[model samples]
Target: MASDQPRIDFSGGAVGYRFRRSGERGHPLVRAAGIKRDHMPSIVDATAGLGRDAFLLASAGAMVTLIERSTEVHALLKDALARAAMESPELAEVVGRMTLVHGDARYLLPELKPDVVIVDPMHPPRRNTALVKKEMRQLSSIVGADEDAAELMRIALATARERVVLKWPLRAAPLLEAPKPSHQYAGKTVRYEVFVTALKPHVK
Candidate 1:
């Protein structure tokens, strides 16, 4: 029998997840990269932590797919999305455009062909524990770090048809430097590295 805990959904406004003004500036790297709300490629948010970036991408018109391995986080995100769907018409549309999958990104990403695969793995929280936001702490606790992010990037590069976008802090080194990026967005502390790759050819 499953635990009798009340599950949280990230579909609607169930978790109070909102795309307020600050969210536009949520990740400096994304904004600095000139990633507009209207120009987005088919995206697979592999790390779908809290689904913020995924929601933003969908709102920006990208066909976004989110993958989460944690049942608790997935349930919370689903509930929040469901609640947001009922309350905000615009958010509802964005949520409608998103597809959530409960599984590991490595195994699942290879099966699909997306223009861009977006990865934002969980990193260390600020040392001032009190200063850390509630959601940030919650996310850290749930997702932890993808110590094998290098491998994830390798698989993402193999799967993506066009490019793989890696969102990381400016201080950290690029993921293995495997796929040399054609472009980069350097923000205050975070950066978005776009690793371009040719789409697989079809042999008709």
Candidate 2:
């Protein structure tokens, strides 16, 4: 478990915390999903990690469910959520809309049918930008890489009703080789691949 990950708070609330890449703003893939403020889906971030991407999704208007397997990570995530709730009352309202489950996303995701499921398997950082955010660096040193990334991807694709999105390096291959993405969003180092699972039939 990532026991050494740094945790911070503001006024007895989870205001700001540190992650491997603390200074980074958001997940490139998640941002690329093109989620509209009003068309928010119920999202489950299977690999919650330090909850950075999950937090970003929530901030984007999706009701997020974060599933974490590491006990240490689970604890820190709760603390951060609580602190975030306390610091920003508005965030607290958002927290009310979110849920954190301290368990494997594989087991939990099946029971919760979200409109969209997001997974970001931990991959080894390229030697070039291996230098991650301080908080992420610490946590990564402890949590290591996700051994079941492929499996998680499979599960997410099956579980999501509308779509399953995978966040990967811009140069990496698709998580699953089935149904090529109907759309994609590219960033400097990463991108979001949107695989549309079902389509509404045309109305007569």
Candidate 3:
């Protein structure tokens, strides 16, 4: 059943266009990730759905570990990364910074001490289904919503050395109430809530 799912491709087509366009400094996701050319943070993407956010961080120079729990989604992501790596020198370099791990981040985060942990759990189903992308719809049909996202945030808070960033719909309530974010970056459709740990000394 999983094999019947569509393969993820980033090398060309609409996804490719978004990939290239996202590399710019002005892209909302990039800015929300707090990426900078001079000081890229080592990041752990706890909910690496399609690897878009992780790839953006790597393209900006951060060493990124992408943790995907779904076997089907992980396979697609792996295949996509392998293809992108062989497509061009620049792409290869970006792919080099990304590491894919198949497992639950809640279990893995304790062992990883990244500068930042990013959590972009699935959003609640939209009333207008057409507003959601086809690829995302497919993903939702397979993996379902991450209902325990609040618990994931708790684990991330304990694991991250510097900060934990949670991506959510612009108008949706946060995953949890306590441990409020130090600040947030808002875009038209999404918002990044940043919880500062301020733990041991680490690169921003």
lDDT of each: 0.71, 0.70, 0.83
How well does candidate 3 match the true structure, expressed as C-alpha RMSD? 2.9
- Residue 3 displacement (Å), model 3: 9.8
In angstroms, how far off is 49's CA in candidate 1? 0.6
**What TM-score goes with each of the models?**
0.77, 0.79, 0.88
User: Which pairs clash in model 2?
Assistant: 13-83, 14-83, 14-84, 19-135, 19-136, 20-133, 20-135, 20-136, 20-137, 21-133
Best by TM-score: 3
By TM-score, how accurate is candidate 1? 0.77
lDDT of 2 by residue, 83-201 (tens): 77876675676577668998898888889988888877775554444335566567676677788888887787777877878778888766667767778777777677877764467
- Angstrom error of the Cα, residue 149, model 2: value is 0.7
Q: In candidate 3, what are the lDDT values of residues 1-204, reduced to their tens digit?
A: 754465566677655676677544666666666677777878999999888788777877789999999998998899999999999898899899999999999999999978799999989754444524666788887789898899999999998877899998888887788989888988777888998886655645
The TM-score, computed over Cα atoms with residue i paired to residue i, of candidate 2 is: 0.79
Model 2: lowest-lDDT 10 consecutive positions: 11-20
Q: Could you tell which candidate, 1 or 3, scores higher by TM-score?
A: 3
**Ordering by lDDT:** 3, 1, 2
- After superposition on all CA atoms, how large is the RMSD of candidate 1? 4.7
